[model samples]
Target: DACETRVPLVLCGNKVDLRDCGGRRGGVASEAGERLARDTGATYFETSCKNGDGVVDALIQLARQMVTTEDVAVQTSALRVCAADQKRPCCGGGGRKDV
Candidate 1:
């Protein structure tokens, strides 16, 4: 639940490539998947790992949802945190200064 509150979530229905090849019924319908996504407050994706379809698109969509212009605006609105002894910034070259 903590992760849900802190991060954007995507509902992916993988293995779409096998929906028609074997002697098996198709998976959930697109309408059903969309309804599920609406109910869960998450983006839905029908991906096929076999042919690499919808994989990159889903990843890009999730990333865009997580990193938004609003978040950047809020971050830039706040005053920069300055360490007492540090010359540059809080996380600016702190670990790589010795390297």
Candidate 2:
């Protein structure tokens, strides 16, 4: 499942340094990653921290997108679930406690 939001979403596949690190580096294919980005309406980026590939470029792209769409409304789940749980008129909010 994918998280849906009215915000600029950038999907990054990191640790790409393992791509050529022998057979122990099996991971998601690039074609599938691109398909997922298309399906989710997000920008895709393949980054390798070791070599710093696509790191700055991806950040710049996301920053540019955020700047251009700054007016979009963001629906944060903290506000969503808390609003639904408040039974009183002046309830502050509800927080989740992991068991």
Candidate 3:
């Protein structure tokens, strides 16, 4: 028998800080990322490893999605994990607050 489970997917655009720096532009456009995410049924997020922007939010959203994919009891446990993560700093000492 073939397993029919669908895993949650998230598409992250890293190094977003360099996307628009000084007079230079790089990295994939937000529209493109969103479009790809939509086409693949995945979530899109722009992140900056240097600044930690969108890091926590993406992680939390992934956790929430994972929770929803699980059974009720497992969902509850996973939600707790997400909630606890929100209390900590994003990436531990990145100084960015979690949402």
User: Which predicted model would earn the best TM-score?
Assistant: 3
Residue-by-residue lDDT tens digits, candidate 2, 1-99: 134335788888788778788676754578888999999999999887778998898999999998766534333555666787776445354464569
Model 1's TM-score against the true structure: 0.59
1-99: candidate 3 lDDT, tens digit per residue? 115556889889888888779967866689999999999999999988789999899999999988877765576678889999999866786776669
Q: Choose 1 or 2, whichever is better by lDDT.
A: 2
Model 1 residue 63 CA deviation in Å: 0.8
Give the Cα error of residue 14 in candidate 3, in Å: 1.6
lDDT of 1 by residue, 43-91 (tens): 9999888789888989999999878744764565453443334457557
Candidate 2: TM-score? 0.60
TM-score of each candidate structure, all chains considered together: 0.59, 0.60, 0.65
Summed backbone clashes in each candidate are 0, 0, 0
lDDT of candidates 1 onward, in order: 0.73, 0.76, 0.84
Candidate 2 at residue 77, lDDT? Answer: 50
Whole-model lDDT, candidate 3?
Answer: 0.84
lDDT of candidate 3 at residue 25, scale 0 to 100: 86
Q: Tell me how far the alpha carbon of residue 74 in candidate 1 is from the true structure, in angstroms, after superposition.
A: 3.7
Candidates by TM-score, descending order:
3, 2, 1
Q: Sort by lDDT, best first: what order?
A: 3, 2, 1
Runs of candidate 2 exceeding 4 Å displacement: 1-5, 71-99
